[model samples]
Target chain A: MRGFLVLRVVAKLLMPFMLLFALYVQFHGDFSPGGGFQAGVIFAATVIFYALIFGLPAARQLVPEALVETMVALGVLVYAGVGVAGLLLGGNYLDYFVLAHSPVHGQERGIFWVEVGVAITVSGVMLKIFYMFAGRQRSAEDE
Target chain B: MAALTLGIALQRNLYAVVVLSGVYSFLMATALVALDAVDVAMTEASVGAGVSTVLLLGALYLCGGEEAKPLTRPWLPLVIALVIAGALVYGTLGLPAFSDPMAPIHTHVVPRYLHDALKETGVPNVVTAVLASYRGYDTLGETTVVFTAGAGVIALLRRIRRRKDGEQEAP
Candidate 1:
C-alpha cells in the first residue's frame, strides 16, 4: 500500500537519527528511562523495519545471517572475557577495579565494554528472531 | 462466551484473528505496565505483539487455514478458571501494597541496588548494574534462553532433509 511505502521511506530516513538517539540514551542511561536494553531494542527495531519493508533477502545480504549468529556468541565471549581478564589481574570475577590502576576509571571502562557487549548481543538476537519469522516464504523465487 | 471468545468464534479471517489476539496481548501488556512491572511489559510487547503473531502466521501457512470448532462443554475449563482465580485472590492478600515503602523487598537488596549501584558500580542505571554485574549469572541464563529458542526453531524445521530422503526411498 501507498501508506506502507511512505512509512518505509520515513523509517529509512529516520534510522540514522534513531541510532544516534539510541547512543545518547545508552550514555545518558544513568539518569534516564533508557538504558542498554532499551537502546539495543530500539536499534534492532530500526533494522527490523528495514527488513519488513525491503524484504528479508535484502536485509540478510546487508547483515548476513551467519554474521549475526557469530556476533551473538562473540558478545557473550567478550563479556565473560572481561571477567577473565579481571581474574588474571588479581581481582574477583567481573571485578572491574583491577581493569586499571584507578578503580573508578576501571569500573567505568568495564561498564562501557560490558554495555557494548549487551548492545551487540541484544540486537543480534532480536534480528535473528525477525529473520526466522519474516524470512519464511512459500518459495525462494519470491525473494 | 465472552466477547473475545465470541470474536474468535465468529472471525473467519486468520490475519484478523491474529490481530485480535495481538490486541488482547497489548491489553495484557498495558495491565502489566500499570502494575509497575516494566520487565514483564517489555517481554510481553516483544514476544506477544511481535514474535508470536508472526510465528502463528507462519504455522498457518504450513498447515492451511481452518478454524477449529468451539468446545461445547465448558465445565472443566470453568472449574480450572475458578480454581486459578481463587488461588490468585488468595495470593493477593499476602502481597505488599503496590508502592509500599515498608515492603520487605524495598528494605532489602533492592535498596542496595537503588542507592549504592551508581557509587559502587559506576553505572548510572541501577537495573543495568544489577542485571549485568550484581547478578550477571541470571543474565547469562536469560541469554541462554534466547539461544535455546533459536535452536528449537531450527530443530522443528530441520526435517526437510529427512523428508526429501524418504521421498527418494519411496520412488
Candidate 2:
C-alpha cells in the first residue's frame, strides 16, 4: 500500500510535465524526432502509470470511460471532417492548400487540426484499452 | 543469435518468450524505420510493442501458462520458412536500391513532395505533408483501423465479464 501511494505521488508529480512534453512534441513534430505517434504514446504512458498506482477506479474518476470513448470517435471525426472540408472548398480530398484564404496559413491550419485528431484518437485508444484491462481486475475484486 | 532464438523457442516461461518476441519485433520495426518505412514502424511500435504484449499477457493469465508438447514436424516447418525467406531475398535483388537518386520513386510523384513540400505545404517534414495532406484519405483509413481495434477490445472484454457474471449468478 505504501509503495502504491509513493508511485501515485510520483506519477502525480510527473504527469503534468509528461503531458506538457507531449504537446510540445505534437506541435513541433514538423521539426523533431517526436510526432503524433510518439507524443500519443508518451501521453498514454502517463495515464497508465496513474491507473497502475492509484487504481483504475481512481483513474477513471479522473478521466471517465464515456469521455474516452467519445474522444476516440471525435478524433476520427475531426480527421475525416478535415478532408470533407477540403472537398467542400472545391479542392481534391485532403488538399489543404485551400483550407484557408492563404495557402501557407491553410497548411498550418490543416497540420494543427490533423495532429490534434491523431493525439485525441491515440490517447483515447490507449485509455480505453487500459480501462478494459484494469476494469477486469477491479470487478474480480468486487466479486 | 541462433542460440538466443533456440533458447527463446525452448523456454517454458511464457513471459520470457513474450518479452523476447517484443524485442524481436522492436528490432524488425527499427530496421523498417531505417529503410524509410515510417508508417510500418509506427504500426509495429503501437500494435507489436504495445497491444500485442498486453494481449499476450492477458491470454497467458486467462488460459493458464501450460507448456505445449514439442513440435514433431519442426523440420518441415523450418524447411518451408527457409524456402519462403530465400524467395523473398531473391525477389529483393530485382527491386530498386534504397534511396537510389535516379529511381522512378525518387524522380516522380515523390519528388514533388520532396521539392515543393517546404515552400508550398509550409511543413518542414515531407513525410507529414505527404501523410496528413497529400494522402490524407489513407491516413483516415489507418485511423479507422485503430478505432476498430479499440472497439473490438472493448467488446471482447465485455464478453468475458458477462461470462464470469453468468457463472457467478449460477450459484
Clashes of each: 1, 0
lDDT of 2 by residue, A1-143 (tens): 33777666777898899789878878887765456666676677667767767777778888889999998888888888887888999877777878898998788788778877887888888788878876775675576
Candidate 1 segments whose C-alpha is farther than 4 A from its true place:
A1-8, A138-143, B1-14, B24-47, B51-66, B70-74, B161-171
Candidate number achieving the greatest TM-score relative to the actual structure: 2
Alpha-carbon TM-score of each model against the true structure: 0.80, 0.84
- CAPRI level of candidate 1: acceptable
lDDT of 2 by residue, B22-140 (tens): 88778778888988776568657765776567657755665557677776858988899999999999999998987778988777798789888888878888777777777777878
lDDT of 1: 0.71
Give all candidates' CA lDDT scores. 0.71, 0.77
